[model samples]
Target: MSDGKTIILNRIREALRENPAPRPHASHTSSDQEETPRDHTPREWLPKVGERLDEQIDLFARQSEGLKTEFHRCGTMEDARAILSVLVAEGAWKKIATHTTPDTSALLEKNRAEILKTDTGYQIDDLESCDAGITGCECLVAQTGAILVSAPSAGGRALSVLPPHHIIIARTSQMVPDLTAALELAKERYGNKFPSFLSFITGPSRTGDIERILVLGAHGPKRLTVLLLED
Candidate 1:
């Protein structure tokens, strides 16, 4: 491996070591008084989030100008199949979802979609070759309109980044109030056994690196579609 690759691997190792598994919470996870979800107006929190999501979508649309974005509510396995059909029909991806379960697997096959099946050791190229990527999310934060993803089952980290488009299948119950709650939940879930990678994706890949010009898909997928299932 090149020196840069070696250094990156070492840094990943260090990060894993530095972030030991989260210790289980003492009282109902974290403190006895968990921060309850707020029942307030949209203006109660950061207004930028709304704009960010809207802008983020617009930015992603620009990145995926030729591609399509679809959002669906998966109420049953059949619903999942239907979504897969649309994704396939649009040729939205060259490959199907990764790191999926048998049920999801069945759905994929039933839909006659091509998928990549691995034990969580797949490389970025495997994902890059694909048209899109999909995985389950740990949680979603409404305040920031982000998804909390952790675990090797999610295919380390590259699965979400390398693909030009991503589809995360999650239930509405995963939605939390804000980032603080997401972090607290993380601290409780793994304690001292945290994985090597944890991602809080608020929106699609973006940057303002080129002469301060905002660019989407500068590093990761230009489009991200979340299929939220009913609780």
Candidate 2:
């Protein structure tokens, strides 16, 4: 492919060697506010960016392999709590569990759901009894539909990996532009105290490793809901 492209470039250069094209002379043609043709208007590329974001979301959905996804926009703590209630109610997640963490307890109320606080570990047996695993996230990227989880709140990598459903509570402000921005945010937030685990979850866990057939919940949750709390 490289050789073919190089040969094509060489031929084009040779063909244009004698009849050199005239380059446009620089001139102060117009002011910064000059009226331009509507068709030639500087591209409203924000729409294209939006389209790309939609495409990424669709790809994540397809790769999710049937893993359910929902986005909740909460403007206040009350709204966030309400969204949490709805998730718990809709999923019928009666036995909610998580590793003991201040953020876990702060985000969840024991009155709303059964909070079974466990030690920091990811044993399959314990996760088997869990209906949902609610944990805190370090950061999220809007560009790629990815979430970063790290630190003592991670509850071992397996807690986020083994459950049938996982609910991640992240502040809306935590979401950045892309993976690069997320990494920069991590660096600023954690300097040298970076957590032991950092997992970037775009969607739910899925695998097409079997006969080229995609399967969801093969090793992790079949559903992943991210609640972006504004408060």
Candidate 3:
């Protein structure tokens, strides 16, 4: 398993050995040239310097695995549907609570066959009782392998909090480089008017408070599966 740093170094080495590419010449600037230090509004506190969409996606998936979560890559919405079907079957997750979101509404219309026993009008009680809950995410933070979710997008936090198994479907476009970037995007999208509730899920809920032994799903879902679409 190659990490991003390893991959980047390898590419640099290969380019140096094979192409011997020349460095770009620096541009001349006026003596009085000045640049704005930062945006008027406070920017997100990003630890990582730059945005690398492809690399970020790879990192997100790898990091998710490190957190004991399953990550699947899909080429399209239909591909996502196929993967979802296989996961549902494998887990034997009946009585699923499917929330209504623009993203999921389209998925359900196109691939309802993959879903089993979904409660369209999902109730808080249904979320607690359902075998699994299927929903969309607000964003995925690659740096920390956390899923950024909000009440508006998830139709309430109960679907993600109460289900024994939580399934999330998101497109590549929703991938954020880091927590800072995710926050910036969310703020821009919502301004001072943010979602009523916001939550970050690193993986299935667990706690090590019991004798310092880490236990998975002690407080939340036992399984967390993410269907990442690569459109």
Candidate 4:
């Protein structure tokens, strides 16, 4: 064998002879000890979030700013309605798509734009034509500034993605401190009957692939506005 190949083989043999390094959070299955499941939780590696609600909201706001998401904290439903109205006026939206939810129905009751409810069903072309999509969310993750939306919470998958602008109307009570907490909440809330679709939307769709120039709405909504109402 060549000197280089022999040296490589000798190194491999030496490595095999030495004891392997223990895997992080791995469970040992020796004869004397009982075998336990490996720990998969990554709480230690995640960013720390405050226990207080205000601190969490603040973190979420800061993260959202970095992600270029428009976030508004409304003290009342009326405030949210006013914000929605302003958005409609600014965008000159002639039509909006949404699902049937108490909050959505209340906010869009007197909207100037035509409403397309996707509760039962909707066409892709019609949904795509709408200027904006309005929907409720499952929860807001403060640590990552992510909004969790499921098919049941928001409208069908297309409603949020097809429109040019995506607006989320959620209550402050739905906010969670981190992704782990959000997952736990989902498990506790849904149990075995979880929604068919679950997604984490960090911000408006964007890409910096072409010449390292950031562009929004590359694959999804160009604008993401969160209207957070106090419960």
Model 4: pairs clashing at backbone N, Cα or C within 3 Å: none
Best by TM-score: 4
lDDT per residue, candidate 4, 1-231, as tens digits? Answer: 579989999999999897987755534445644443433256755899999999999999999999999999999888988999999998899999999999999889789899898999998888989999999999999999999999999987889889999999999899999999989988998999998889999999999999999999898999999999898
- Full-model lDDT, candidate 4: 0.91
TM-score of every candidate: 0.64, 0.63, 0.72, 0.83
lDDT of each candidate versus the true structure: 0.66, 0.67, 0.76, 0.91
Candidate 2 residue spans exceeding 4 A from truth: 1-68, 99-103, 110-112, 119-124
* Per-residue lDDT of model 1, residues 61-84, tens digit only: 332333333445578767877876
1-231: candidate 2 lDDT, tens digit per residue: 478889999999999989978754435354554544442422332222233634544443343333355666556656666777777788787777777665466668534666666564444676678888877787766655677887555566767766688888767556555566678888898899987788888787778998989776777788888766654
- Tell me the deviation in Å of residue 197 in model 2: 1.3
Off by over 4 Å in 3: 1-50, 109-122
Error of 4 at 153 (Å): 0.1
Q: If ranked by TM-score, best first, what sequence of candidates would result?
A: 4, 3, 1, 2
- TM-score winner between 1 and 2, please give it: 1
Error of 1 at 204 (Å): 1.0
Top-scoring candidate (lDDT): 4
Q: Which 10 residues in a row give candidate 1 its minimum summed lDDT?
A: 60-69
Predict model 1's lDDT versus the native.
0.66
